[model samples]
Target chain A: MNKPTVLIIDDEPQIRKLLEINLSSKGYAVRHAESGKEGLLLASSHFPDAILLDLGLPDMSGHEVLRQLREWYSRAIVILSVQNGEADIVNALENGANDYLTKPFRVGELLARLRSAIRHSDASTVVQTVETGQLEIDLMARVVRRAGEIQKLTSTEYNLLALLARNEGRVLTHQFLLKEVWGISFQSETQYLRVFIAQIRKKIEDDPNRPVHIITESGVGYRFQ
Target chain B: MAAVKLHPFWQFLIGTASIALLAMVCYALGDSMDQWAVALILLAAVSVLAVLFDIIPVLAAALLSALLLNIFFIDPIPDYKIRDTESALLFFIYLFIALVNAVLTNRLRKQEKKIRDREEKEKTIKLYNTLLNSLSHELKTPIATIIGSIDTLKEIDPEIGSQQRMELLAEMEIAGNRLNKQVENLMNMSRLETGTLKLKRDWCDVNELIFLVIQKLPATDTIRIRFEPDESLPLVKLDGGLIETAVYALVHNATRYTPKQTPIEIVTTYNKENNLLIDVLDSGLGIPETEISHVFEKFYRLPNSGTGGSGLGLSIAKGFVEAHGGTVCVANQAQGGALFRIVLPVEISRLHV
Candidate 1:
């Protein structure tokens, strides 16, 4: 198997240096750029497997860079930013970024997110079934089973769960989820999402209050683990 | 000017009504009171309104008084139009004096307000300077230590012993962690002070929120933080990020202030009013009653407390909680411990999709 290439676009020299050391030691090829324009140029020539794009770029807007790369590139583009605002995170995700991690992130967490992003992007084939813990979701059958027993779920509930399960370990924002499960007009109806999520948690989670399979990403979004 | 903010409509009503009352009083003393005296009194009333109330109300009062004077005080008995030259001259002159008084007093009040606003702005700048000075010290210490340790490591790269190298590396990590914490606190404080701290609310499970907060805190050998979530707690809508930071601050404070091997407990429950309640209890020495109130104040540290924090944590916590229209308070427990409680009015989700 070939080693995956990871490109990091960050203006801060120390952060770039530390990330290079941390990532290279884990046997991944790391390329870096200090500005958004340079990053986009290098990305075209390098065709890296995964890109770490910083939101606060020096030359142009990082969001603009992400959008430009996404126009042609079909690989994972994880965002690295100092902005921890929910709106910022949601905006990045909505603009086609695969994952978002705030700066000063733990090395272990950054590596994990990178691994998940690369792993998901590498799988060209469609996923038919998603499994985590004792919960099993069979996409073709449109059936959810808990502990080998078929758990009854409404059609809408099944669609919502399957969508979340299909993108396991990646956060799906409320707007995205509502638009996908419901419609674009239902994007602002977060109350409906809340009610459905609570119902799903009750049916699947051992403790609905302390859910582990379906993780809430603060006020930004939700992720199925 | 009175501190009480009377509405502009009420001020206009009161000012106009007072002028009518004065005219009626002059009518009761019909033969004795002079029309000139009534005009003088009305001009004085307009000036008083300008000084005490807003410009719009004062302007209205001035116009109303002029009309009142023309209708009753003029020589032509109860005539809307002034016929004689003396009465007409008196009307124009009275109108002129009343308008001038209103304009002058209004300008004076505006200038006074401008001076007051500038003074307040100066005070804010002074406070910002104090915060910056304190932050410099807090931020520089960790950075200095990190640079010093890293430099020493670089110079003695080959000669340093394994244990010594490990110690230096650990020291660097500690300094780096402290630096990161201070930077985070400074960013949060800036967001709060600039009025940019907006809550991004969503449906969240409080138990999970507390669990995540605990997972984020640095692990220590001396104390252990425990959580006992209410089993029947519903998924409530809230800004999970803000509430997490608030609860984290309270629990982190307990770990820093208490003795080693102390057990910290976090309990969550909803009251009858459907407000989500979170309590962080510590079995350490309780806070002094006098210090409790000041604990949540910005840059307020306990007199006997050791130095580690920039004294912004609790204040930031209070700010975040208050942004949610919530309340956070502290009380010493009966069993010689301190309890920090946060109460937030949250919408409980009970629907089944």
Candidate 2:
């Protein structure tokens, strides 16, 4: 079996070398690019399982690369950035990145994140299914089953449900969920999130009045249990 | 002889008329014994008004009165004008005296105004010079550190141990962050001095802000940082970034001042007195009472202290805290350390987060 491959795109040569050595030592194929243009070319040519992208680049922005990747690829895209503001994180995630990592991160933490990303992206179709209590989710097939009955969901609703389900135990901030489901622009219209969440609860929860899975984080956003 | 209070033009007219009258009186009384009395009265009255009203041009009026009295009140009457060669010579001499007095008084007024304007300009220039000196000294230290660190990183090889590499990288990161923060402080100071950093109030968790501040301090891992907040510390409406930056500056200052092996303590507490206090106490060399006031002034360092700093840390911290409706103060602790205290008013809980 071929080892999983990861691509790292950063302007700093030292950072690129550090990531390259660390990931290569962990038995993953690692390719490095110094600019966004080179990174996008390598990403398309190699079609790696995941890409660690830096937001600030010399040639083009990290956002542009994320947009192009999302157009053709469904691979795991993780943003490696120095900008840790909630808005920027949400924006990057909205632009089709699977996750975001702030700079000066520990090598151990980076490795764990890369492992998690690669594992998720390489999952077989049958194992990609998520089951929590009576809810059943077939991610690849874009179908949901509850109490032995199939539940119909629009593409948006399905994506939102899948995101919440993926991060079930963590508090998903409004920015986090907005960027994940609707992309960056949808962050401002949080009311849309509220309406969709309500519709989702109506479809999934036995009583929308007393939600069991999706919980609102008040001013922050929502969390799934 | 009436009190000679008059405007310049009026004084000129009155002086001319009075001189003519004096001359006529002298001519009419040429053989009488009261000829000098009219001339003396006119001189004394106009001179008194000239000094009293700051209208020293009245001196010119007095001189004109004397000239007319000499010409017409003495031996030059009926014609009421100069006829003899000696009388014409005296009239010319009195006219020269009046012109000299007017020129002297005008020169004095111009000199007084010039002195006043020069003093004002000197005061403004002094203030600007002080500000520039402080700003440049504060800016230079951090920039130098950043440049030095970058140069060092470039010289090191790539195959160093993970620990050594990490330390160097962390140092570089610290220097970069310090440069970023110093620039931010300069910008904020400019904004504050220009009155542009308006507060944008929002619901914020004070605990979360404290956590963020801790995250910024990598040195805190070595030092024992103790953060203890009140159980009922409610959500506060405040400018989060400004407060965070202020707290970070305070922490960075504390860490820098404290000894390497000593433990630094950061405590957060709130009281019913309507204030939230953050105290960063360090077991380091305490500042003398003489230097406490100067600590918050930009670029003013203690005498003979070799601790390298841009010296904008405390001043910027103070400015940012004050901008957020808070106050910052420093004092030598009782136990041989420095204690920096920041007090921010507990904002009214607006929106629940």
Candidate 3:
């Protein structure tokens, strides 16, 4: 099997080095570029499986680079930016970046988000139930079950659960879930994400108090187990 | 109201009229009067004109006095020639005396005016300093409260879930305390700047004052305050309430920054030479090295420091200390933490009522 290749375009030498070491340790081939100009040339010529781009670049912006890449290639683009404001995050995701990560992000969290983005690109599966032991999420038939019993969910709740279950075991940030499920503008509505995630857990998880599926990462976002 | 002149013409006319009157008096009275008596009258009249009219030049007064004494008061009477050698010698003597007096008085007045101008400038600068320091210090507390609470909320529940609702209420309490501190600083700053920091000075026990400060700290149980007063020292005369406020600010700052586990040391010692010194030391991230110089500067937060504090703590402490004729200094300790030393004069007479 060919190695899964990832391209990283970040201005900071330390960040690029750290990502390269961590990603390669997980058995992925990693390539790098220091500027948006070099990133564009590399992405077009090399055609890597996915690209991690920093929105703040010295020569050119990551938004422009993402726009240029979306013009031709149907490749996964994840935006890694230190610009943590709500509007900037929403705008980046709206401009066709598949995922976003704020700077000072924990190494483990970033890797989890990367896995979800990669899984999303490789297999675009849209059918049937994803069951692990007591939990069952049937996407095609539009039903969810726990411990061999059917559970009811709202249309929004069903959509949210299906999205998370489809990419289960990969971390989904608050911004990513809101953008994917509710649209780009809902990225800043953390309250909505929290309330609905609670409602879903209450219906599916054996103990809502100690959730086994959806987990909250303080000062960061959420992830599904 | 009279119209004020833009030109010097009115001033020149006044000078000319005063000079002509002095000349007429000398001419009319010169022959019957002794040369000394006539010159004395002319000198007196010129001095009055200089003071009253505010336009006659000192040089004009000297010149007019000299011409009158030489032409009219001399023995020559109405003639240009002197009656004798004695008369010519006396004429020069009177002229020299009058000229010397006028020049000395003018130089003295100039010196007095310069001193008066400098004193006024000093007064204005002092008032400006008080106003600026107080205003910045006053605004700092509330702004810190609002920002700190918001940051805490973001930290505790980025998602704002039902389980973390209790944390939000506690965050609001912290913010409220910050706002209250700010309003108090504003009121104190205004009262102090207006020359109204009236001390209700009395002979009070130093230990009680220290205890009062400790009572004001949040989570008071966590802090270990050590107040050691000298046994040989006499009872101190101070504004008990004001000094307590100053000590409260110091203790609060020390407790806030110190690791929740570290002990705080507050000590008081009396020196025969420098009077009394009280030191408050904490083992927190000491005021940053750069901020040590400006800890007393109003509203100046240390670079890269936490945003929870109002930045007015040390400035208000300094104000209260200085108002009682005391000196305050801050520095970081080598072992760790910050030390604030306040020196107060043992001699109570140094404080202004």
Candidate 4:
């Protein structure tokens, strides 16, 4: 079997070096590009299995790159950004990037995120059940269970849980979630999403205050692990 | 114009005296001028006083002039008596003129004060803009360092010497750390200014917090940081993300101010009052006595300190801590160095774990 390949687009040499050394050691072929233009050209010619993009590129913004890539490319594209830059991360995710990692992240964390992003994008099998930390959500049956206990959830609650479960490790933004669970007109009703999420957390999380199954990305959105 | 402002009392004394002198002049020139004409001249004098003095003194002058007109320049001079119907009417008319002058002048003065207030507000907005411009300007040094180093590395034709290569990389790391610090400070300041900082209060373990923040600090081996968590410490409910940034700024400042080979210690304890007290103690030359008060002020750099910082770190720390209903204090330790403390009020239930 051929080894999976990864492409990195970043202006900082140190970040590119870190990604290259770490990704290469994990048995994946790695390619590097220093600017947005070169990254787009190399991505077309090489068609790497996964792409790591930095938002602060010199040639073009990371949002612009993601927008152009989404027109044709359909593989996993994980964004890299500085910490507390929630707006940019949300924009990238909304622009069809699968996942994101803040800079200075540990190598293990990056590898884990890359693995999840690549797996979900190429997932041909329709998942019926999602399980994390003893919380099992059966999408096909519209059921939720904690350990062996069946959780009774409202119809709205079930839909929200099912949506987050299906997109497992990806950060779904507030606007996207509101539109998907509610209608397009409800995109700006973030308070509704918050109330519903609190209810869902009480049902699924062991300690709803410190949730593990459904984690909040603060101002961005939620990530179901 | 050089503003020769008079005290309100002095203005009142001068205005009333000037009205009295005008009344005396009219009394002396009584046969030459009509009583009604005298009233007109007195009203004009009161209006001039309103233009030059404060409202209180101007209003007082108007009333005094009317009283003087009645007492000294009336139909029955030196007596509070009206002799003829026309003269009584002229005296009342003179009094009415003074009252009208005060009212109109009072209204005009209030309008002028309102305009001045609006101008002050615009000045404040302009100052904020200047602050923002200077902040962006402060970012240029680190950016230049990063670009200049990269440019040098790129121009190398042959295999770069390993020692020089490592130095360049180290320089870039330091510059990147400085750049990131400025960006973090800028974001936190904007968040505070815009009121967009929403506290996400979750259970926070002090042990894990210390580990995470230390790991996140710029890669450095020079200054040693030591902390041992209290085994019985319970999880405090607060915004872990914000508190982490606050603590990072404090410790980061210590790293910059303290010299090499010195150690920085962080001690977290649950106080008797049920507040979480965090003390970051550093062994170095303590902050100057004069600068202690101004340390938390935004962009207030110490006059003699040659450190390169945006001076927003401490202020942001104080702001975040305060947002959580907490207080931050700094004091020069008696032994040496500075002691920084953060006290956060937490729920009573969080204490027993």
Candidate 5:
């Protein structure tokens, strides 16, 4: 398989160099764009699997670059900014960013988020069946089974469960889940997701109160094993 | 001393006005009122003037009232001589009481003013002491670590393993970051104190903000943070930078005080009243009742907690939230932990679908 391509847009040479060294060593192709304008030009010419953007670019505002890139490019775009503030992250995410990581982040963590973003974008071509312990979900059949028995699930519950199952072992943020299952209009309606999750947990787990298949990440979202 | 000394002319004018007013009222009511009633009315007027005016003015009012009582209300009207013993005793008592009331009221006012001034001075001194104490420790520790590690790396033998060298470098990095954070907090506190912070308002998603806060925090294996986002929460208009820093400060505070492996839960919700609520709760030792009120005070730390902080975290958090017309408060959870809640009143026009 050809290595996944990553575009790095940042003004800091040391950071770009560090990322290139680390990402290249991990069998990934890395490209660099030093400014927002350069980044836009390069992105239009040759698309990468993921674009790592810096919010504070020298030529133009990083937010503006992101806005323009998102106008056409639909693939994963991860933000790597030094702002490290909630508003910056939220704005980037709302503007169609797949993931966000602050500067001085651990390479291991960054790699994981990158892989998740890439997987999320390429989810259509990935595996159709997800299995965790006693729980099995067959996306092709639209059926969920536990302990070799088919368990009945509502369509909404199935959609919620499938979204969580597809991102196995990865945390699916609440906003992402709500957007995927209930549409963008219902992204902030967390109670609907919680009620659906509880129903799914009840049908699939041996003990719903002490769930094993679905885990709650508290202030975050949900994670499926 | 000159400022404190009242002008005799003005004092006389005030005293004469107060007495004249009382005399006029008494004279008007003398047709229906008895002598004793008139005397009591004069005494009450003297007491009221004593409470409202300076000591000199009050004393003058009292003397004038006493002289009127003796001249008009005595058994022999308009006579300086007193024929009866009871009448004489009453006149003397009235004069003594008026003078005593004036002096006592003035003394009480001065004492109250002194106590208030002293309390204000002590509060300021305490705040400065806390700042200095925390600053000395917070700044010196990071600087010392950086210096010590760098000195070791420089003088060490060339044969040292690269891994060891890398470890030292990491130590320096951590120290440097800690120092940077302390300085940032100090600057933020200064901005809050000097009222120089400008709010850059934007629509904010609470869920994304919490995730970023968790992501920005150093990856910890021991402390787990769970964020439950409200599905129906509307995007709130806020100074996103300030609110983010405030929330980060609260979470950082919980991490420092809470024990390892304890869960810190951040939950967000929105009500019909257009207020966004965010709660950061920790399942650790709860704050003592006595310290709960002071938790957000500038440079105030829980006594003997031994946690390393400049005591500006919560204060800055509070300052930032309040800047957005919001309030941040802390309370001990019933099940043993601390709960910090931030309620921001958002404008409905700023909420987008």
Candidate 6:
């Protein structure tokens, strides 16, 4: 398999150097963009699997760059900003950013998010079948079974469960889950997701109160294992 | 105060012309009207001129009118002599009234101008006091933490474990971020105050925005925040940076006030009117009934609530939301928490697939 390519678009030399060293050490092919304009050009030319963008840039605002990129680029664009303001992060994500990491973020957390983004972007990884604990999900057949018994799930519940089971161990944000399962319009209906998650937990877990399969990353999202 | 720029030559000419015209009219009507009536009319003219003209022009008008009254209407025509005692008394009273009216009117004008200036100065002083009071604590706390942690890391024993070193670094990071947040709040407050905060409106996905906010905040193992977004909610056009700052402030405030490990919930929905409603609810000690209205006032902290914040967060949130043509309000939830609700209007076209 070819090594995944990552792009770092940041004006700060130190930040770029740090990310480059860390990503390169992890055996991933890395590219760099010093400014938003350059970042856009490189993103188009290379079509990197994932793009790490900084909100503050020299030539143009990082927001404008993300806006232009989202117009054409369908791949993941994770924002790395020194601005920890909720509005800044929200704006970036709402504008089509895949994830966000504030400055001084742990290297471990950054790598995990980058890996998840890249994994989601790769079309080949849409696995046909996923088996975790006592649960079995067949994406092709659109069926879920537990302990050799076919479990009854509504179409929406099945889709929600299937999405979580496929991307096992990676935390799927409520927004991402809603968008993927219920479409873009339903991305904010978190209550629907909660109800579905509870239903799925009851069906798949030995104890619904203490779910071992679907874990809630409080104030963040849900991760399935 | 700047001097009232009245051309002296013009004002004097107008004042002289007005007095001469009044004298001619009074002389023409001398046969039908009495001297006292004429004198009263001339005094009234001086008072009218005082209201419209500067002090110098009004004084010139008043003096000219008095002299004209004496020469043209006070018993002896075209002369300064006053033979009748009653006529003399009338003449003196008319002059006294004109001079008093001019002086008193000018004094009143000056007093009004002083009051206006004082009000403006008081407003500015109040703003500065609020900023300075909040900054003393906001800016100092983070800096003090950063300095103390750095000193410990540098001067402390080299035998400190890696874990201890990491903890020190984390402290410094948190302190530095806190300092940065305070600075950001200050800048945002300044922008709001100066009316320079330009909204860079864009089509925003509300779900993504909320998730991003939650993600950016340092996840505390104690506070459990759940974000519930409406599935049918449309894309909103807003300055994402500003709205996110506002929502974050609310969440941060929730975390700060609530006990550790308490639950804070964020709920977003598209109302019937196509407006986006975001609710940040915290299972903490709810705001006092009397203090709810004052919560958004700059530097307003609940009395006796010993919390560590600049108290600019809620006000900043209010400023940001209002900038977007939205309204943010707080209420004590019946279920035991404070609810901050933000409602933003979303254009129909902005909603999409």
Which portions of model 2 miss their true places by more than 4 Å? Answer: A83-87, A121-174, A177-225, B1-202, B211-226, B239-241, B258-275, B281-286, B304-308, B323-325, B331-339, B345-347, B350-353
Error of 2 at A85 (Å): 5.7
Give the docking tier of candidate 5. incorrect
Cα-lDDT of candidate 6? 0.81
Per-candidate DockQ vs. reference? 0.41, 0.05, 0.01, 0.07, 0.03, 0.05
Candidate with the greatest lDDT versus the true structure? 1
Candidate 2 chain A: 10-residue stretch with minimal lDDT: A216-225
Q: Give lDDT tens digits, candidate 6, residues B244-285.
A: 889889988888888888889999988888788899999898
- How far off is each candidate at the interface, as Cα RMSD in Å? 3.6, 9.7, 26.3, 9.5, 9.9, 10.2
Candidate 4 is graded, for docking, as incorrect
* lDDT per residue as tens, model 5, B158-244: 867889889888988888788888888988888888998888665555665675577668789223888765646666667666787
TM for every model, in the order presented, reads 0.78, 0.53, 0.39, 0.54, 0.56, 0.54
Q: Which candidate is the best by TM-score?
A: 1
Model 6 misplaced regions, further than 4 Å? A1-5, A29-31, A37-49, A60-76, A81-106, A130-137, A144-225, B1-114, B129-133, B147-157, B180-184, B187-191, B194-296, B301-307, B317-353
Q: What is the descending TM-score order?
A: 1, 5, 6, 4, 2, 3
Q: Write the per-residue lDDT of candidate 5 for residues A67-92, one digit (tens) a residue.
A: 99999998888888653354576677
Task: Give candidate 3's fnat, 2 decimals.
Answer: 0.00
In every candidate, what fraction of the native interface contacts is reproduced? 0.57, 0.00, 0.00, 0.00, 0.00, 0.00
lDDT of 6 by residue, A112-170 (tens): 88887777766677588888778888889998888878899988888888888787756
lDDT of 4 by residue, B1-353 (tens): 11138998899899999998998899898688777777889999997887777778877888888777777767677777778888788777767767777777767877877888899999789757757665766678778888988987899825679788889889888888777777777888989989998886755655556655776675572238888767577667777778888898889889888887699999999888889988999998998898899888877767766747777888899999999999999999999999999999975333332
Off by over 4 Å in 5: A81-84, A131-135, A145-153, A167-176, A183-185, A198-225, B1-136, B143-296, B302-307, B313-353
- In the range B1-353, model 2's lDDT, one tens digit per residue, is 22334676776666566556655665665666343455455555554444333444466566667656664554545345667776666556555554555455545656766888899999778757866775565556666766766676677656566686667667666666756665666676776678877775555556656756775677545345667544356566676667777787777777776666677777777678878787888888988888888888776667876545666667778887898778999989888888889998866553332
When just chain B is superposed on the true chain B, each candidate scores a TM-score of 0.77, 0.56, 0.53, 0.64, 0.75, 0.67
**Which model scores highest in DockQ?**
1
